[model samples]
Target: MSIIVDDDTRLVVQGLTGSEGRFHGLRNRAYGTNLIAGVTPGKGGQDVEGVPVLNTVAEAVSAHGANTAMIFVPAPFAADAVYEAVDAGIATVICITEGVPAHDMLRIHTYVHNLGVTLIGPNCPGALSPGKANVGIIPAEIFTAGNIGLVSRSGTLTYQIGHELTQMGLGNSTIVGIGGDPVVGSSFVDILAKFQADPETEYIVMVGEIGGDEEEKAAAFIEAELTKPVVAYIAGFTAPPGKTMGHAGAIISGSSGTAAAKKAALEAKGIRVGTTPTETAEIVAGIARG
Candidate 1:
């Protein structure tokens, strides 16, 4: 009942011959994720951990029914890797590579929408649906299956929050890292809408940072329509103005990316806002437990 992936989900690693592809792919398989195949052009005849290697996503998908693609290609070729998965009809694509030029991602974003495919990350820690599947580079030990749904722009922050929530006996239904790129795939509103409709999700935790108008848009949505209890946290409150924080998406241009603004916006919409990582889980658990 997770949004996209599950325990039975079949996965293929694009650029599987590379170090990142080999490493994370092995970790994913070890985590009980179904690692069906890997793709590396000109290395098609090889195998990684008994999983057949194909030169193209089309070949892998045709032969092994791999509907999900975890991409580890370099930034320059990352866009094409995404398109390859989409063309192969991959239902979900998770890109773990970072530093993709914004223009490349914008083009890929448009192409993915035209193809009706889902892209998870470009500079992200990836996502996990707890006991179902682990896509991207998120650590497997920090998650547990329960009632809350988490959406975050920071990978390490998401892990910390999940750990905190787990300590409180508050597990998650689906934990997604929407990435921290300026023009990346997915947003707070996108994941939040999905969680709002998911029956297994009773409460939600949204981890945001200072950047873009996405948080403002999410606040408007929550104020107008969403009924599920939302607990939100914004990072980079102590960051200096005009400086881009750790995340590429964590820029505060003319106060638009201030944590205080995000908190105020969410609070005005009747959502609880946490000032710190520890507080994030505490507030979420409070509303969820109540």
Candidate 2:
């Protein structure tokens, strides 16, 4: 069984009337996700690709039994959307919007934890269980069901590594994009813990970036808590200091969010850290084979 999503998971689009929302919603339906409903406050009566639209998440959940929500709301209002989804008892929420205000995420994060719900990302691409269900915007073509559990902070890098793994005949149990937002929902450690408990997951691939100390925290967790082999990659080797590095790339106060620091932290705990996305697959395969 996959940790986050599977074929049995039902999906709903929070901003279904919008272009990006509609595009991905349709793709999710086509890719075999159970696209049950859509939510667009003012466009309530409208239909996006035959999926019924409702004004609020509560209505959608009541009408369609949607347990998962994919939010396409703008960054400014993403927090409200997430709050609504969780308040309405949507068990899992995937917010795909980027650039959410830090304060907004902080409040929403508290709400999520309080409600005892699982939140994936406010700026993330989402999580996908290939051949089962997908909630978010990762390239569905690059995935398949297998024993490896993959999680990443970089959207495109996760896709690249997953594609490489597929090409090498190594598939994933679940691939999750924890998002790149600094204060967004979930973390490498969060996914790692879940993967650790998942029986189908034989190993984990954690992709991180320079910025905060989240990777270091995950390294510590790996050293103490996890028994499975963990292969990792942290981007932003040449990224300049003080830049956000595209999604919450872990910002340090005075130091640059450099790749060397993150790699060193993980490697110290016996976790293999890859230098490039291409090498991540090779390292994972090597670990699994060993």
Candidate 3:
């Protein structure tokens, strides 16, 4: 079983008429995700990839029973799109757009939490439940359904790690990219808690990067509550101090958010920390073998 999304997830693409939405939206549909409807203001009565498009999220909900929203609008209007999704009572909202103003996400994050809605990313790869549904932009090729649960902050790293697991015959129950933004909707601890409760998930591989204290906090949570084995890889090991990596949120301000510091914290919590993605997969493989 997947964490937030499953086979029953009825999806609506918020910017289905736009380029990003049309591109990934069709791919998601091809991966067998139920693309029930689309939302593009003034583009109501249109259809994208054979999915109906509505002007408002409420219309999509009322017409097609859409519960999950895949947001692909440009950064400028992305926040309001999310607000519209939440306002319409969407239970899960995954924002795939990047460069959204931090202040906008800051406000939306608080608002969504109070409403009990789960938001995946403001700049993320999205999520996929292999053989069930593909909600966001995670590649459907490398993933195969099995007992492992995966979460990551880097989209490309998510694919690489998933590839490693599939190659090792360690398939995933679900793979979620929580985004690399400083203020993401979900945290590593949140996804870790979900994997811990999932009976299908026997192991978890978290792909974090050098940026925030989220990894350290997740390590503590694993020590205190999780029983499943967790192997992790943190990117940007050699990233120059104070230089932002590929992601907007990947900049390190001080020694506290260094890859070294994050690795030490995770290792101290009895979690196996890998120096590379391949090594991380081997670490989990060793545990599964043991």
| Decoy 3 TM-score against native | 0.98
Clashes of 3: 0
Residue pairs clashing in model 3 are none
Q: Candidate 1: TM-score? A: 0.96
Give Cα-based local distance difference scores for all models. 0.86, 0.86, 0.89
Which candidate leads the pack in lDDT?
3
Off by over 4 Å in 1: none
TM-score of every prediction relative to native? 0.96, 0.96, 0.98
User: What digit string (tens of lDDT, one per residue) describes model 1 on residues 89-208?
Assistant: 898898888889999988988888787787888898777888888877888787899989989888889999999999998888989998999887777777888888888888888888
Residues 1-290 of candidate 3: C-alpha lDDT, one tens digit per residue = 77777899999998999888998999998988889999999989878857898999998888889999999999999999999999897999999999999999899989988888899998998888899999887888888998889999998888987898789887899999999888999999888988999888998999889887999999899999999988989988889878889887887887768888899999998788888888888888788778
Candidate 2 local lDDT, 54-100, one digit each (tens): 99999888888999999998987888898899889998898999888
Which portions of model 2 show Cα errors greater than 4 Å?
Answer: 248-252
Instruction: Give the candidate number with the greatest TM-score.
Output: 3
Clashing pairs in 1: 6-132
Model 2, 143: alpha-carbon shift in Å?
Answer: 1.6
